[model samples]
Target: MRNNRAAPPWAHRWALPAMVLVTVFFVAPFLLNVRFAFSSWTSFRAEITWNGLENFGTLIDQDLLANAVTVTVLYAVLCMAIQNTVSLSLALALQRTSRINTIFRSAFFLPTLISPLAAGYIWRGLLAPDGAVNSFLGIEWAWLGEPSTALLVVAFIDAWKWSGLITLVYIAGLNSIPRSLLESATVDGAGPWTRFRRVVFPMLAPALTFNVAVTLVGALSAYDVIAATTGGGPGDHTRALNVVMRQQWGQGFFGSASALGFTVTLLVIATAVPLVWWLRRREVAG
Candidate 1:
């Protein structure tokens, strides 16, 4: 008689534990969150009756919804734009081999290694009216205090912290380009701009997709920087969805907060779905 193929021993031992943890921590909590989204909640009790789409209606009908969606979308777009532009520029500048390049790259990445809260606080001081930024420029604008400048400052802080990460991603993509392709292009009288536009960029699509996706999600979920810098202050001018959710939770609106969270997740998926599909098609075509 032939022996039956044995299951992997590691699967029998580790897989069950992994599944248990995932179910307990991730799947269970997510289900509970969905349940909360469909209920009415107070500080100590869930209404327990099915509210169906009422929670969603409240979330949508609020004026904060308009502000949240607009600001979040704008933040995502601006973050992607600034991060990609600065990162690609840095990647190009650092493609050369030199001690200076190594030092600059390390320095640039230092901010990313710091906690977002810490980085935000650091910049908060720097952007104060009497601080380094204004002192250096001789402009006495209060960065985080003014409604006009608060959101801009928050966006700038995020870009400063994360552009290094995108730069590294772009650098890896840049290195993956076939040297032979670059040399061949040079031989064919292709200028640096042509080589980048035609050969390098198309190849960097995968990296671009990743960088943009991360930037979008990160910017949309932005709270740490704003919390640390302005605490979503100046009359909520810099308040993000995450901050709003926190405020609701504090006000004993757990169900409402959960509903807002679910909505944000949906927004993320809505933004990512088309980009992911388009990138996959591009990969197939390439």
Candidate 2:
């Protein structure tokens, strides 16, 4: 008997509150941000008059937009590369389900649980001119003070913070591969490196896609660690787009700030869409 009865009203009642919350919080704020991006709202004035693309023009003229975009892209790329490399290595090292491996995994993952700001602050002290790092290395180098290395240092910190989570994802993907395939490859006289390169690595495409997309996007929008570490210091060398938006907002350039936010959103969508599409194709091919 195929009883095609509609779902009861209470069965779906909870969704209403969730939808309302999304509308009130995410959707509404996003729409308002778009509205303000094209306006002339500032601390100097109350009336928000539409000025077309003037806010964007102002930002472009100031070179703030270009600088922020460049810094953000470089930071994101560095973080993505570092994080994936570290995470993949960790995943491989901890692939076996042994007591030692378990303990080490837990130890490594503890950092992921810590607040980013706290991590940044801790690293800031450690990387200070006369801090633990310098003490250990016996070289009193200013890690966060140098324009050349400050951005890289901050990017490394961000990558370190999130590598554990990405490692677990890779571990999960590795574990999902059937043992039969590995055993078959072993019997066929395939070496460890060859088997991994030809079999294991290709099989991890889905995980790779997820980890790469997430790390890249998250780095693009990074703020907390950088804020606590450098505050976009060394003469705005490490200033991400979000930090630039915050500076504008602090100075009461609401419209310009909103324009920056909108630009970030567009950039994320632009980068992520194509990246994901290409990654998905690789997954299929793999």
Candidate 3:
């Protein structure tokens, strides 16, 4: 005797609800931006008028957009580098579970829970001319008010805030390695460096890919932290693409801002697609 009930249909999976939510909240708004990118608006007081490609044309007439590209790319790259290095090192150090390790893990990850605005303000205070950092170092210069150091300091601050997240990601990857594999390597008389290089690093490829992708995207879109700390100063030295978009908005260039944002979205997509594809290939090869 056999059961007669048919299996459930898989045409409409449970992901449909999430897809619908994204369509409503994200995709719709993105399409709206595309539509508005070709139109002009000064403020809420004025009607949006179609201006063809004039908004994009204005982007080419000025050096602001070019400078923004350089600043944004540099800042984002620094953030990705600092965060990944700190997080991976922390993960390797914290791999062994112990009472002390648990306490330290909690302490390190505490920054992630702090609001970006609050973290930015706190660092701003610490980096002030007369603040704790300068007081401790016996310097009179303003770290966040100088063109030479402001952008790097801002990137470092962003890295500090998010490193804990990638630490956790790396920890999960580290913990997933089988003890048997490590034991086999030990039996082969492999030293720690050799064992890690040959076995552990290869296995952690997925975590690396994930950390890189998320951090790159986050750094490119950084806003609130920069807003609270440097506000795109000193003299636009720390302005990322998003901060530049905000400046355009503040100056009542809504249509041009939309075009700028659209350009940024295309840039991120262009960057992420290739990088992610390469990482996925590396995962397979590893």
Each model's lDDT: 0.84, 0.92, 0.87
* lDDT top scorer: 2
| CA lDDT for candidate 2 | 0.92
All candidates: TM-score = 0.91, 0.94, 0.90
The sequence of per-residue lDDT tens digits that candidate 1 reaches over residues 1-286 is 8655877667678788889999999999888888888888878874665678777678677766667777777767777788888888999899765899999999888878888899899999999889999989999999899988788778878888898888998899889888999999999999989998888888888888898888987788888898899887888687778888888899887887888787778779898999788887886676
TM accuracy, model 2: 0.94
Which residue pairs show collisions in model 1? none
lDDT per residue, candidate 2, 140-187, as tens digits? 988999998999999999988999899999999999999999999999
Ranked candidates (lDDT, high to low): 2, 3, 1
Candidate 1 local distance difference test against the native: 0.84
Alpha-carbon error at 82 in model 3, in Å? 0.8
Q: Residue 158, candidate 1: how far off, in angstroms?
A: 1.5
lDDT of 3 by residue, 84-147 (tens): 9999999999988999988889999998988888889999999999999988889888889999
